[model samples]
Target: ERFRQVIWPGNSTTVPKGWEIPTNGKKLIVGVPMKKGFFDFVEVKRRSINNAETILSGYSIDVFEAALKKLPYSVIPKYVYLKSPVNYD
Candidate 1:
């Protein structure tokens, strides 16, 4: 998701007059804090993808699902990742 710097009392392009509003470059810009490498969600997602790959090596999700099914529903996987339709030939 993109962060917007919509102006108050006006459209997103312009702010209201006589308003002592301060932006501090935070509303428009994307980041967590301290100007670290994670200045946006994309960087965070990329890091998570890399980390998951390392932890999930030699592990199959199907096996995990089978084990989960043997357990109670409360202990089963929550919010499973499902495939979505994509444009293809």
Candidate 2:
């Protein structure tokens, strides 16, 4: 049977019934942008390889991921690309 689970932000332990709560910890998926810039936080190497594969690594992303790992709950990051400038508005 299929069950619906609703997760409240900042609430780690408590969850509705029928939801497969994380016994050890929660697995969170965070989005990250991979853009190349000399002073930017994350950088990506544009190369022609497997279409399903992407090459990305940087100091800022590494540190951020590390911090997330240190949290009490488990966090899984999902990187997203931001090609253009970010609009705050």
Candidate 3:
């Protein structure tokens, strides 16, 4: 079901002549920004179980992960914790 071409980093020739090489990396870095307020839009929560494992779950996170899975090729994203929401300006 994978309809996209898989090209590793530093190996651009694997891409088709007319196709553009996608981002290079086995795991992509995804930043999840959350506001300080407890809104439902983008709220990030971290849970620790006996200090063994850390788990992140929220409405925004679930949507982001689901979108990634729909891609034709494999894309594993490593979530980066942002202390505060991102400011584009």
Candidate 4:
């Protein structure tokens, strides 16, 4: 027999009998824009010695992290630094 569980936000903390919690191992890739104007929103910096080392921070990242905490399932976010001076056109 297959069992399913439904978790409502702020409803209850107890798990129902015979219900199994779902697990996801896949990671979600998130792109952060590299802009020169607004450093408060998002900022991406690479080390001079090792280009592979990236440092990400700012207000936008904080907001995104807060939203992720509200989700019922766990999500792993892989941040990718986008090219600077991005043009939509």
Best by TM-score: 4
What are the TM-scores, per candidate, against the unseen true structure? Answer: 0.19, 0.51, 0.54, 0.64
| lDDT of candidate model 3 versus the reference | 0.65
Per-residue CA lDDT of model 4 for 52-73, tens digit only, reads: 7888888999999989777765
- The worst-scoring run of ten residues by lDDT in candidate 3 lies at 13-22
Error in Å for residue 65 of model 1? 0.4
Residue 3 alpha-carbon offset, candidate 1, angstroms: 58
Winner on lDDT between 2 and 4 is: 4
CA RMSD (A), model 3: 8.6
Can you tell me which runs of candidate 1 are displaced by over 4 Å?
1-59, 76-89
| Residue 42 miss distance in model 2 (angstroms) | 1.2
Model 2 lDDT per residue over 1-89, tens place: 98666566666557534324356554455455543355366676656666466666777877987897676654555666556556424
Q: Could you tell me the TM-score of candidate 4?
A: 0.64
What number of backbone clashes does candidate 3 have, counting pairs of residues 3 or more apart or in separate chains?
Answer: 0
Q: Which scores higher on TM-score, 2 or 3?
A: 3
Better of 1 and 2 by TM-score: 2
Query: Compared with the true structure, what per-residue lDDT tens digits does model 1 show for residues 1-89?
Result: 99977766535566535313433322222212222232232112223644453111113444554675564332423222222324222
Q: Scored by Cα lDDT, where does model 1 land?
A: 0.35
